[model samples]
Target: MKNLKIALSLLILISVTSCDDFLSEKPDNRTEIDTPAKISELLVQAYPQMSYFDIAETMSDNVFDSGMPETLRKNEQSYNWDIQTETTDIDTQAYYWDACYTAIAHANKALEAIEDLGSPASLNPQKGEALIARAYSHFMLVSLWSKRYNPATAASDLGIPYVTKPETELVTKYKRNTVKEVFDFIEKDIEDGLKIVTNDYKQPKFHFNVSASKAFASRFYLIKGDWDRVLELTSDLGSKPVGKLRDFASYDLLSAVDQRLAYASSDAETNLLIVSANSIVSRSYYSNRFYLSGARYPDIFGTATSLFNKPWLYNFYSSNSSITVFLPKFYEYFKYSNVTAGIGDPYVAEVLLSNDEFFLNRIEAHVMKGNIATANDELEYFLSTRTVGYVPTDKLTEAKVVAKYPVIADEYTPFYTMTPVQTSYVKAIAETRRRDFIHEGMRWFDVKRFNIVVNHETTNKPVNTLVKDDNRRAIQIPLHASNTGVELNPR
Candidate 1:
């Protein structure tokens, strides 16, 4: 009993130890972290310390000028593809470079502390989480500052520094690795973590419980083009009588605002993990709902001469749903928060992983492997939740989904200047992701992985446009870390 009490007390201290503090200096050697229980406290924070989506969100096609105020200047510049927008000085949004490494540092410390504990079976769970946490952090870091992992060019492309040791002095100086090396390290960590991780966690949703860790692994394999591994991981989920998709119809959709909040609720069955990021209150685009047509904002449904002219292009929220006309559609602002989000969002970002993502991941894998029948079944299972009155029993087809959820419609278009979109199963997946994971910045990862060129425009007489790619795709390393030899990505 006394030992449990001591471990809990150490954990509280660990939780309060901000990532910044850990990065700024080394831990005192005298502090006792040698025991498994004490080491578990450090592993409690295996998740990324910050929100992972903002800058990438601005760089994607999901957002538009929408006439809403940009809470921060960086958001506007980012959306415009201004080369100098995300300087180290602007700390408004979560900085991927620092946040990711900080997470790695925590994981490394946990592993190092438990090294001499002999990694007995009793200590496997802690060791598993630490290893997985380390891999997840590096995966996020390389995903952003470095280019997407492409085998052909990865051998030559520069990757983010992959930190392994918990020692601060070692982390203080580092060099970039090839993209392939970062991916190899991530894979190795997952293997090591999976071997030790237990399927059961006391707080399953808060940590990477058995199912959640599998889900994370499935995500990684999908990106690596390993369809068989994805299928193997999801084999159990495939035959379950009730797939893990959230039954949106079961929610009170009669009230759109209430429903949006309900979908993102803490206890919502859709969530596998729950984490909240601070809402950047200053950025208008971050919380905007305005979409203009001509000099005046247009109504969702046209009346009289032009009847029933509704815009279509797979946006999360429609004009009618967002009560605050200028607020971003699809988000439910039940309350306000004061925390800053260079890490993640306060309430909305908390619903990071869910059954919805798993279903989509399986569907994509099935499609890639040419199992169209299986893929269709999974897709139908998913649409039942998102589309009102959708019947999953009927055999659904790719054509049906594309028709019902077309990105472009006859009468109205979104406020952005768009290039032609291809109609394929992949596009279908991207559109579904944009809707299912809106506002949370989940769509940006797909944008980078596929190198989807998104163009943004200013509503001026001449109409300025920025075609985003190249240097804009990668983030610049923060100046704080620059003195220590971490090379900044070309911006």
Candidate 2:
């Protein structure tokens, strides 16, 4: 207990002192004399910090893809399963947790400083942007530290502490809030944010634009099952004057495949916010040099082998003796640049948040409400645009596919029956999303969200189950948070 207390004291002291470098810098008249711009710069710092929460490094590669060796094509696991910890490496979790809190603390500092500056109206858009950034930081922290958003269970589940002010004193203890409270707070922040940050601005390549803020809100709405709001916000996304996906044939597959992908690449017209390559490269460097290299089990494919070695497999490989196995999607996405590239454009491909996803979300709601026909039509519409050569009216029936290509899944299951249209929709969404997003960090979330049973297609058998409440679902809360008396999610 004494040692723990001492450690906590040190942690708080470190947190407070870490920002001294920035704080110590000579303040220009703008920062010292003016209030709003200083707050805006603080908010800007908060935005780039989110790129530190890389889904690939922390969640996808560490958790969802960890099991791919046995389930996917050609890989081997030399270490016993016991060697695998929950969600991510202990060190990795610590790093992410620290990064998140650091961001939160920075935002908190801005908010704290702004409070003394004057009334909220005095700061205008800057105050709103600061709040938005703080809320986003908290949202990311809780999403990683807590379980999936289950409106039913969230009221009871533990969430990260909602710290609103910078802690200057040493050894401040905190406790968890319920997930419901966390999300409620996040929603309130977004509402507040929406009111202030109305104009678009072009600044550093790494900062969040106004459209990106809306995109984040759109994502939040989608996750919360607010279909109307999602549709309303995403409706104007792909229209003229915004952005669109590049034509499939026009994609420079070779060059684009291995490069570190930002939110928007050069070809993208509507990507709202993309993490810069510097952030990616820095994180990737840490992951490759430390975490991946130190992993106990050999990759299934072979260490040091690229995931694109066979794009069809979509799994890791082992080199004969190397410690690293290339993620094909990661490789493909960042193929154009080397490790040291600076931040790229935020728009890569206008991530069409499409009416399709909205349609599917509505179908899901309808299925939950037992409206079968409406669900089926909506499902069909979503599938039609997804499958390239097919017309929008092409039926997605099992019989049609079985008749056309003898090699598809066995018996045709109707959209109703024991194989619920909901199930079909989930599968369709998963498969289509997997193909479309590739390395964009959406696949693993699909696996977790739907509790999908991943199977080894080569072996024609169920491989493993990834669901909430499973060990696979719980990432270790950063040691710093845990040490500070913050309650972590149960495994």
Candidate 3:
């Protein structure tokens, strides 16, 4: 159901001691240790932690768009503004951090209770599941709230606390571990969990499974730019037949509710990790905006008239007036309901890492190693698959891309084409990545990684905004962590 509220309630019940008072205080019936069933129930509490996924996705996109008013959303789009110094107070970052830790605590409690079950031979599959789940929750926490791992800086950089126990001990003071240590702990846990959890459990339709762990590994390797490991993990995924990519061009925007909903509900072949739609908005955000006539373009979803109005059908005067109409970005992803619903679950698409991305990575590696022809071939492969119209050659030298997208080149000065082979390769890979994962929370990270200059209208003027070295890169660590002696990342 991807129901986040249920997830939150269950988490609080299992991990927090304050709620223990609500339990019946019959002295004779009270037990010092948790029963197996009780522990299993606690493990179930981890479900709501997926809410962090929705929060991360929305905040990453909505907070960065210029179309939304600052007053209406209030620094939601702006990152690391001086006025909001206490990073912990930021809703998006705070919510994600809290949700992840809560889930981790529940997993820890489950594992501790399993050990207390005594005989190792009697251990249940649920115990291993809990271990893997805890490790994954922690992995996401570090990636989202902290800086990218650098061995040199990791010892000084604060990572989330590695709470392996329920912390029932009174006066238990927690401390943050180094980023490197945290990742090391996570990797070890995953390895240990893999040993215990066999591929025998009936696959839960909307929960984490063994394959999901592999998917996570693939993503982790990709983030670290470990091309060989990325290839290995993704190849493992390709061996298992799962899902397929949906052709975006085939969807009809103006259809009946049931028809539209059916199309929306259909999962894209490549959808890897998603939170459940039922856990977030009640209906599609775009659909609601369109129906209410509250849509705007290049901002939130645009106005309904701007969306459906046909300029060719109108008179010359009316057509001239309609030229100013702008299409909304929201409609690009959310035109259907099914797609919205499948937000939280670990989907197959994420596991099937793109062949295009793989070649791009290979090309980049070659360029770095000074293998010119190999790099050029990889670059051509990527660009050829990107569009149906154009086919690039191995010998295609870098030239100004002014012929295509002439308006952008004309409007913007010094708009150079792919001048260097390395530049061409980077651009080709980045563009493919963007098109492949539109709402998957990869764009802003890409913007930062490539150090791309963001040229867009701030207040309807062509303003060139450089996001490089921006304070917005590191999200504010949660206040709860800070209060508990966990150090915050530098703002």
Candidate 4:
């Protein structure tokens, strides 16, 4: 509650026109943030309204949007794998370009204000927060609008400009940094920012408090293939004593408010960082359009085709009779008065980082480092929590894992053929990440990192296929971003 107190007050600081170029306008004079407290007020405004789920989740294979309405053009275009599915509304934009830069602008504003305060230790917290915020915003923008971070080609590949200062003009323009430069800038900010960010906040989950900051570090290190740093940074799991999965069987899904608990902001056990999300995150309308594909559809109910045809449903779920539906990893009941009566909620809060992701991060790091037994232990612990009565027998022998999940061998390409032990652990990490982060945009991140091939031929419409390294993976920069000489990502 205290987090929102300052956050909500300064949320009105977002005064830029959506249609205009990012950072094209200046903030109003009365709203100038001048002090450390005022910087916190403005820094909290650094989070974007919409997440990657609002835009690029369609590019991943987790969705089945055949059920979506024809009127939702952005969703439709993205579903069909259009490289340039541009939306006219900045508020509802698919790529979230304006929203990201607006948050960056806020972070820059906070950093600029702090610079004039005699470089005091009292402002370090705000300074640290602004640095991470700025780094995070640029990271998201670069990941979305530029090529995937291929180290060899990164110096040549285009990346989003890392904006550090507040904009002052109506037509300010910038150039794209190379992917390697973007990575350098983000790493520098995070490495320094984490050192300054202390565990001192009323609402730890809402702000990037110690736990969330470490989790962010883990993600950054994992992306960089620096596993040692990832483990070291996350050794202290901030507030949670144990990273346990939420037992859905104990939940009262029948109640709308109770059902929402899975993603509620106050839930500290599962989530490391909780932030306000786009209204589209709701289960209402386009939310549940998640197409449970033939390759990976856990049919808890007697629904569609699945590799686990027999009693696999009951094996995972302790009780599915009460709740006949299981699709999105996080969901709630919706009330559509004029449309189909019962739907899903459109107001679920977004989870930025979570314990489950860390668990997987550990598993991957350990496996890659040849700590096979430890990696298997991490996988077993995660499974025992997620599935009912899941017991590890014989340290999850690779042969046994392949026997149960042969599809994993193919889904995890190139190195999917790793010796049974390592391959099994990698597949386990991949599957858990997918299942845990359904509808949360993490799958898209995985898709980019893994270079997973995504084909959109599920619907009756024309089929669209994108193999690894396809240009579609790099979402197009908004035409307006090119305004005033800023270069557009090549289409």
Candidate 5:
């Protein structure tokens, strides 16, 4: 591992790397990352520590003016579809941008260390994890900071810098890659990682385990309109997805706090990958000026909104003033720096990938592939667990799903074409996803992919509508990154 030592020596010579301090002066200076064990330890930081829930959720159609007096700059900016100015806050868009790159820096460092260790077969797991981690961070970055992937114009759309190599210089100038280039880079990393990725981590749920990696692949292909690949990636989850899906029914048996704690627990088979993120999103659920309001709560989770006409198993809670409403999904844990002073950070255990979401992705793939009956059957079984008082004898047919989600012309106009029936099924799946991941920020991806319109209203202000193909759909690149020569999105 002489090469590794030399690399470490060079790292020591450098100060903080990147304009945003994405890399430290010496990441592993305390101990050499010469061994596979050390590389694995380093991989723990490969996932973004900051949560994008607040930024994304506020921008989606799921929220409205709660009439709450509390306000966070990030929340207000996101709700109004404006560029965020809160660059240093834990839950702001800029913080998440830097956090994603920071995660990528760690992955690149581990990959470099692994290469220096001779790229032995013994370190395949670490190599696989590092590659997938790098891909995931870049994928998130491009998905947020760039326009939605449109094959016809991806070559021209500005993407976030896809950093793959460890930084050795104090300050590295980076240029934004094209959307097509970023997607190409991400796809290459994912395919390579999948070949050798394993589920052998001490805590598989915290790392890019086999299932989580496959879930990510399915998500990527689904967005790219590669229906066949999406199905191939999620095939193992089965058509029924009986035990692999979330047990929402059982969550009702637990206390509210317990449900929040168990939502991201490794014990839950549905949770494929979870990470502790520096976030105040849980607190924001009930405190933000704009959030899921009591008036709009029924529009999403009410019994009439369900296909089976049953109440959702999701538990809802109200703020002290009953203005804001939220699901018991996020659990915040305080990490005390000084126990006596009660000063520290708020962390939320976030489920980045899950069997439930993967299963929905598979169903969408089926719908896109013209397997209407199969998609209907799978969607039926998948929703059963989440629907209260679900009757086993009741069958969900394609006709019924289509009838429920009628094709409103131009409601969803993605790059790929969809038949009327396919459009209905896709709409059904998107709605399910919207309900399933209410406060998790997953809806924002669907909003972009489907070109869904979001009408956000505030007290005494005219309705702010994010219409289809709006330029604001793509969040602007962080001002600091733009100042450093990275391209900002067109307003």
Candidate 6:
């Protein structure tokens, strides 16, 4: 019995160590977090290292089966809407899930330290950052793992556990909160955090600065059907966000590598929050079988698809095959642990929040508020930035929007009600966003929120369809997490 107990204890220790947060590192170093500077440094890890761009993008309507021979299980699984079984691989949902909680742990530790130090007024910024970081991670967790937030059903929907405190026990089991409970917690954190959050960091873009905080809040409220709050949060960004938006026209001139780096660069005014994500998605540009291929590329990027009847200003590069094509958004920066061996981990600078998205959220808010003219104007201005040879004459009208996106009945059914005109305008905005954030994995959230059906075509097999309100819309909880007593989303 003694020997068996020892063996089991060792097994548990190994499992704990293998987990993302063993809670014994620099960020979680309880002793080291005695000072403010250390706490600030700790909060750096508060942003998730994992990338959801690939997973989300694949699951959305943006990518198609290229019929390419090269295969990545994660990409293929996501494209088919299958439960992602790969638990530890970068760019997988499970990795992202672990990454989120690992990030939350860092935030929780920092908050605990602040409380331990008597919660000085000087530590307000740190406290605010920590709270918001916690909220952001939890928000992401629920957004991806739980059912889309429906107010009527959210109270009963399963949410990822909202972990607010540092783990004191090694094998602490967690239970899933309901969607409403999770949102309530996230709202409380965001509200508390925003009240005291500051853009005081040396490199503010990497952190949840004032703009990033508002941008995040804009998305949260946008999902919650709080149109007025979304509009208010993003009000300062101005209707014509010329300088704040991405300079896609100039980006078109840069080299492919430069374009990749520039898209998520701190130098770019649009990128509000950037994180160095531990990801291999950039490398998957060509190797993955499921990808943005020539067949689907033209329909997405063609002039006919654009309301302005012009080519998009996006920088697209074809792989060596000229078969698997992709946008130059995610650029991998490798960090070598052993220089002599040429071994390293791949990292991509991912834009978590941006002014471009913030502006779109504003435009959508306008549409929801029955401000059709204002929404049209803003949408025109936003698209002009990304349209090739965009002239002032290329205008946007409700007529054009309706013609472009003639509402199919029951096509888009969000929680909020909309007029037929409003629905058309919203669909137009969604299409624009779908193109804008092609590789960013944001489209998946929209797919969930709008309850849009998706069809995936395979060369040999029959078409796989994800119908509206399909239970599979909520990605299954990671197996490891579920094994630890967290309930899985219903299949």
Question: Which sequence of candidate numbers ranks them by lDDT, best first?
Answer: 6, 5, 4, 1, 2, 3
> Sort by TM-score, best first: what order?
6, 5, 4, 1, 2, 3
How many residue pairs clash per model? 22, 29, 19, 7, 0, 0
Tens-place lDDT digits, model 1, residues 82-112: 5334444322333555666767877887787
* Global lDDT of each candidate: 0.58, 0.46, 0.44, 0.62, 0.85, 0.86
Candidate 4: where is the Cα deviation over 4 Å?
1-30, 65-71, 83-95, 237-245, 252-256, 284-296, 299-347, 391-395, 405-421
Which digits, one per residue and each the tens of the lDDT, describe model 5 over residues 1-491?
Answer: 00000010011111112222335555334345677777887888898989998888889989988887778877899999999987877888889998898899889988988999899999999899999999999999888888899999999988889898887776678998899999999999999999999999778998999999999999999999999999899988889877878887787787667778788889999999998888777787556888888777888888888889878888776645567777777777776667677677778889999999999999999999999989989999888888888898778987788888999988998999999999999998999999889888899999998898889998989999999989999999888888888877888
Alpha-carbon shift of residue 11 in model 2 (angstroms): 34
For residues 1-491, write the lDDT of model 2, one tens digit per residue: 00000010000111111232443343331133235656665665564332332343334433223322322110111011111222233223454455566666667667777778875675656666666677777776676566667777879877778877766455578888887898898898887877776454554223444555666676676567665665565555332221243233233243323222432453344344434222232223123322233243233222222111222222333332334333322221222223355322221112323323333444454544455565556555444433334454455553432232242242222212324344444454444454445434455455444443332211233444333355445455655567678765565
Tell me the spans in candidate 5 whose CA falls farther than 4 Å from its real position. Answer: 1-22, 26-32
Score every model by TM-score.
0.77, 0.63, 0.61, 0.81, 0.94, 0.94
Model 4 clash pairs are: 63-291, 64-291, 282-345, 282-346, 283-345, 284-344, 334-343
Candidate 4 lDDT at 13 equals 17
Candidate 3 positional error at 469, Å:
3.9
- Per-model root-mean-square deviation over C-alphas: 9.2, 11.4, 10.4, 7.4, 8.3, 8.5
Q: Candidate 2: where are CA atoms >4 Å away?
A: 1-34, 48-91, 120-122, 238-243, 246-248, 253-267, 277-419, 453-468
Candidate 1 structure lDDT = 0.58
Over 4 Å off, model 6: 1-22, 25-32
Model 6, range 1-491, lDDT digits (tens) per residue?
00000110001101001223336644344355688877887888888889988888898988888878778888899998888888867889989998999899989989988999999999999999999999999999899888899999999989889998988776679999999999999999999999999999888998999999999999999999899999999889888976999888887667677778799899999999998888888877576778888667888888899998988887677754556677778777667666678676777789999998999999999999999999999999999988989999888888999999998999999987899999999999899899889888888999999999999999989999999899888888888888999987887
Per lDDT, the best of the predicted structures is: 6
Clash number for model 5? 0
